[model samples]
Target: MAATGHHGAPLLVVMGVSGSGKSVVGAALAQRLRVAFVDADDLHPPANIAKMSAGEPLDDHDRRPWLETIGEWLAGHDASGGVVACSALKRTYRDQLRHHAPRVRFLHLDGTPEVIGRRQSSRPGHFMPASLLASQFATLERLAPDEAGEVVDVDQSVDAIVQEYVDLSAVG
Candidate 1:
């Protein structure tokens, strides 16, 4: 894809609960924007991964370090811009990430439990299991109007989602 717009922006965080296609869509968005891509999952500490692998929902305490690491990455890439796939399920978590990159914006991948749960079940080899989908949805807080972002429905094709994101970013 061509990078037509979205230049001079700070980091973009593709966010949602489990199975929202953050990684897939995020990578596409990064390529379209001509920026590097990072998966927040890759930054999680071993203990957090183990906890999720065992079907446990992580607490704020458990996620703080991981979130901070992601924030640091955003800070590091502020100049060049980048995209990161993270489940910034809570407003506070998003705030924490914003602290690192003040100009950070988010692309929320929204979907219903039925749709997302189905996707989770079909996936494999991830630390988070289908069982944890409930917790992820339960913890998710939709983007506020004041937030510098837009919500793209995950039901659409990945290309459509990316196009919508590009359109939105161009306007933003």
Candidate 2:
């Protein structure tokens, strides 16, 4: 079956803190939806990458350009549609994205700190360290009632989370 969003074609932003499986789930969602997939991590500036690699959390000033880049990518796909994996941790960040792609919706991967911490620790060679997990959790802002999206718990299999997101997003 052809995949669709609450609207016709969908531009989904798979969002969460680090280790919430945004990349894996976003890729699967894009595949299911038969659309392009882009990981926002790849759009990060070298300075941001260096900061994260050195165990520093980025301030808003450090992230403006990166957010603009991701927002531009989303806007570029306005007609065709796509899915993007992004750590849209703050409400302001998501708002910045919405400015570029008004029709975009989010799939927030929610999880407890313990769950995310374990995943981060087990994972290796990533620019973000497990040490920064706390900061990630602290930075996360829950989606508001007016937000056009759904939150999927990350305790289950990636497939389950993706399925839930697809189902929910299709409904409203």
Candidate 3:
């Protein structure tokens, strides 16, 4: 059965900096929740991908369109529920997403630079380079008290991380 949140359906965003296991954990969580899964990186416009692939950090101007696209996806899935893996590093970005899908909750994957840096190195061909990890971390704003979300440490196994979210969602 699909997971249900305080709302009718659970719209979850697995968010964090690069290399924080957003994709891996998000996909697993979605599977466990029996919800659809989307990696927001796949929704990026070519220009955005090109810019990031070149090792430049994306400014807000570059991210606006992309964020809008992700928001649209969330809005589309509002009733049916879905999980998205996104590097929603800033509160404003998360706010934009929430504006589109008001019932959405976030799962922030937290980890130190050293741990994430090691993971980034093992990712062979991802567009996001390890070189930009610092920028990703610098941009990250932890979930505030008002945010509808929880943070999970990325040092644990993917199953453990996914289970934690599942248990938390069950409680909420």
Candidate 2 on 113-148: residue-level lDDT in tens?
999887778789999999899999888999999888
lDDT of each: 0.89, 0.90, 0.90
Candidate 3, which segments miss by more than 4 Å at Cα? 1-5
* Residue runs of model 2 more than 4 Å from their true location after superposition: none
- The worst-scoring run of ten residues by lDDT in candidate 2 lies at 1-10
What is candidate 3's lDDT per residue for 2-42, written digit by digit as tens? Answer: 34446566789999999999999989988887778999999
Model 3 steric clash total: 0
* TM-score to native of every candidate shown: 0.95, 0.96, 0.96
Model 3 worst lDDT window (10 residues): 1-10
Candidate 2 is scored at a TM of: 0.96
Q: After superposition, how far is residue 133 of candidate 3 from its true place, in Å?
A: 0.5
Task: Sort the predicted structures by lDDT, highest score first.
Answer: 2, 3, 1
Ranking by TM-score: 2, 3, 1
lDDT of 1 by residue, 1-172 (tens): 2333444754799999989999999999888788899999999999999999999999999999999999999999988889999999999999999999988899999999999988788788878998888888888998999888888999989999999988877777
